[model samples]
Target: MSVSARDALRMAALYVVLSMLWLVVAGRVLDHLFDGSVAMAVGSHLSSLIWVLASAVLIFITRARLLSFIGLGTRRRKQDSERLRMAEAVFDTTLEGVLVTDRTGLIVHVNRAFMRITGYQQDEVLGQRPSKFKSGHHGPEFYRQIYTSLAQTGEWSGEIWNRRKRGEIYPQWQTIRAIRDDQGEVSHYVAVFSDISAIKHSEQELAYLAHHDPLTGLPNRLLFNDRVEQALGTAQSHKRGCALLLMDLDHFQSINDGLGHTLGDQLLKRVAERLSHWLGAGVTLARLGGDEFGVLLERCPHVGEAASLARDVIEHMKEPFSFEGHRLFISVSIGISLFPSDALTGEQLLRNADSALFKAKANGRADYALYTEELTAHAQHRVETAGELRRALEQNELRVYFQPVHDLTSGVMVGVESLVRWEHPERGLVPPGDFIPIAERTGLIGEIDLWVLRQACSQMMRWQAQGRSLAFVAVNISSRLFSQRGLYLEVAQVLAETGMNPALLEVEVTESAVMDDPEVSLEQLHRLRELGLRLAIDDFGTGYSSLLRLKRLPVQKLKIDQGFVAGLPDDDDDIAIVRVIIALARSMGMQVHAEGIEQAEQADFLLQQGCQLGQGYRFGRPMPADALKWG
Candidate 1:
């Protein structure tokens, strides 16, 4: 309604009201003036005067009601002007596209926000329906569902895609409320919409960051769990088996500790790259955190194929990487769990695969193990045994065993290998293999190694006290212990404390440990040798080593790997390698011993090859010190 038109109506109403009030006042005053007691001439004059006054009063009251309703008064006009201004500001400044429709759903009112949001001008949208902005982005069923909901509830809020002025379709959050008539009928709809495309983009970005490994940009533990659940469902539908393979980089912590986290992170990226490159389209590869990765092979045909793929992955990781000016070598221990074969649920599969991984590391690092019921049992037993071992070590239940290493050239005894023997009160003797690796991983190897050194020397001294021929006492150095900074110093201290001759104390180290960093190993060996002690390369053929480098070390002896000697006579490769190693040792002016000798032929062959030392089950298995009893 226009202000001019409203004012005209107010003026007309005021004129009518004033005219009525004038008539009422005039009627009453005329009655009073015409009273009988008054003279006719005087009453006539008074009646005329009263008639004028009543006419004036009627004009004033009628004018007041009309003017007030039309905002003619100062206070009313100011308030009305302020309200109109506030309404105009809201229509112009609100972010949502708002439109007020008439009873027939025709757009009667539109705001600037509507024009901006719908890509239409005031002329285009003023007479048109809100459906003008529909982009056909929604299906018929989708539209039907939304309309049905809106009709039933009289209010609807949802996401809708609408076309813009440039014909571009964009998603928006829309709220539609039914504008009701005074008679309670839904006369029209007031729709308010906001563009949510940016919000959607932000949500996607947040999801990616949350569920992926930042270092490798690969799916992390969160996403891995989702994939596992998906793979399980697929497997059930297809009646096929899925494999969950858990792989951990062996000795990754050592690499990080020795080099730095920067190098470690770089290595992880390289590993992730290789894994992603090798993974097939159907396989899901994700980092489970740190050095751990998970692979879900959905619809795998056979368990063997999963194992083969795992092996391939391990082989790929075995390749050397140049990280931070150092040739970094990494190996993976993979554990495989098959659906229906190992477990049923996602959690079960992951747990079983993890347990298998434990076995893989236990059997040795750089290997793979398949999940089985027996493996699960072994894992549980191990946990129990670890607890027992902890208590046993604390209670002085662990004792040292001595396996005599005899001189091959003569029928004389030489050094005895010191082996740890655990005697559980109820379970009797437990083998070293059952607990050694666990101890190493649990950070108990240092103490165990020290105890072995001290006990070995003490016993060797006891033998000397018995007037028996006291020979060199050999103690195996685990990789964990060998990697320590002051290993040689610790050994020298142990020997001095035991009052054992340094010449009779031999520290045996595996070839892998020494070859890990030859320069450092050589320095440590030299330090030990300078202490009047001996350094022997233990399990000689079990690791990668260069003869050229070995010659520079302070190594005085080579112990042929039990693997090579055990299969000798029948396995030509084993025999040939053993013979060549013995010849190499002889040429280097070092003694050679054939370990794991189990047969007469093997022992005789090793002796014929100029190997002067033999330590094996054929001679005597590792036995408790009390069990040795001068045998």
Candidate 2:
């Protein structure tokens, strides 16, 4: 398919003829209409017509100069000196480099752009073979392919690497063509190329961004999984062992909330750097989304090696990270799964490691746990149970049971605690302990608490219509629900919808809920108190509540935790704690309420210890609203 000499000359003649005809016809027509000003305007930088004009001029110059530079331009003449000047300027100032060689592949003619791009002078490249520009990046086969394509197709265009005069290799997008004469014989070779180094650099940067996290410059989840798959393959092939460790920064959300997100992002970068520093050779570390990091040990020979590494990571994270003159303390929890034992596939391995990580966090943060069958079973159960609980709520299978809160001295039921019970069709009545924890963990407790609150308000209105002597009905609010900003608004709406008095509604929040964020919790509590509702801190001694914060709470009642009340009369330690709580409640002008008074002796001791209100199985177990009785 090599272009013949006659055809090449014919095409070149046609291009020049068309360009000259356009210039003559349009330039004369516009000159007659606009007094030649338009013609001059179209010939300058503001004109889009310069590209076609310049291309036609370049082809004419290449043919004439190409023959003259190789000593075969006997018929070439300077009939148009002005046009030649314009063509020469185009050849000199064009951005793309142009080179012309004889049929022998000797360099005969080069434009100014060729010298600028190749960093060579005209005298340096003249009379030399084009092969002198070879960069040594491509082998003999690469050049052979180029020659083969050019010989068969008459032209070749592709990306190539070439050397500059300064010996620096750079990429170029080049096109080379064989020029032929009227006798159908090859006369010279012409090449056009542009330095594409910037484009190549941009592509490399884009590829790196695709696989690495921009914030921390660590491998992202996509790359992390790929590395995990590779490690697993290597381990399987060599019959070695691999371990996948997933680490999470405990209480990271608190830090992010207290400080700004800018500092939080910087903290994450520092954490990634720390983890990378502590990682040993052959370990692949990655950032698996927010506040989570994954590590792969491809050569974990012993099972204890994974444990030791997890311990090291946790201990290193225990050291405070300093940023902007602030020392921020954080802890890490790690979960590990071994290859060929815990899981065979990467997906299963990550899932199992995450389950173990849940166990580590549950056991109290700053710890590590290994994968086990029980962990998988527990994870499956949680998933299945959460789904079932969602269906049960939608089907209205949830029922509220009431437990009486009795006055200790008079043994009169003053209030009822509304506790939720899931009446499963297949499992009968599911206990609160069985499903309540699941609800809390899955974040369904917020919805369930709101539903129970609405149900309790409606039931309270019914009880009031029945002339019951109960002063108030208490409903337990999970910490997840109690911390919500809209809790007060929801309660207000429920009261308005049910026509129930807010004064008779006692919302019981756990001590941990109030202590979670004292300032925010205080604001929420004050909002609820403004609605004329009673607030009580339940499970009082189980959390770390400072006396200073406790004094600022707008609550009127303290329900002592059942764990402290379980050993009331016999255990001296329980006896002292019960007395102190009663005194603490009285000193704050708050009513004292004790939970889990199962024994008569415990009730008598609590009453003697100045605990006014108490609730337990001894008085009456949790039952339906209609079944509740006071004696």
TM-score of each: 0.60, 0.76
Supply the global lDDT for candidate 1: 0.84
| Per-residue lDDT of candidate 2, residues 1-631 (tens digit) | 4555777778778877976776677666555655455556755433336646677687788788766765543334443666799978987889999998999999998999999999999999989998999999999999999899989988999999999999999999999999999998999999999999999999999999899999999999999999899889988999999999999998676566546578889999999998888785667999989899999998888779999999988898889999798898899999999998999999999999999998998899899999999999989987888999999999999999999999999999999999999999899998787788789768899999999999999999987887776889999998778766788999999999999999999999999778766887898899999999999999999989899999999999999999998997888898888888999999999999999989999999998988899999999899998798756
Residue runs of model 1 more than 4 Å from their true location after superposition: 1-214, 226-241, 250-262, 280-283, 298-331, 358-369, 437-446, 463-469, 496-499, 562-578, 596-609, 617-621, 626-631
How close to the true structure is residue 377 of candidate 2, measured as C-alpha lDDT? 94
Q: Put down candidate 1 lDDT per residue, 1-631, tens digits, no spaces.
A: 8997897788778867866776677567657666664554565566567767765786678678867866657777799999999988987799988888876779988788888777788888887887888889888898788779878998888999998989889899988888787889988888888999899899998989899998999899989998899888878988999999999999886666556678899999999988888785767889999899999988777898988988888888878987567787789999999998789899989989998899898788799999989888877777787787789878999989888788777756676899998888897887778888778766787788888899999998988888767468899888788877698889878877889889998899999888876776777788889999888998888888987898899889898999998788889899789888998999999989778988878888888889898988888888866666353
- The numbered model that scores best in TM-score is 2
Please report, in order, the local distance difference test score of every candidate based on alpha carbons: 0.84, 0.89
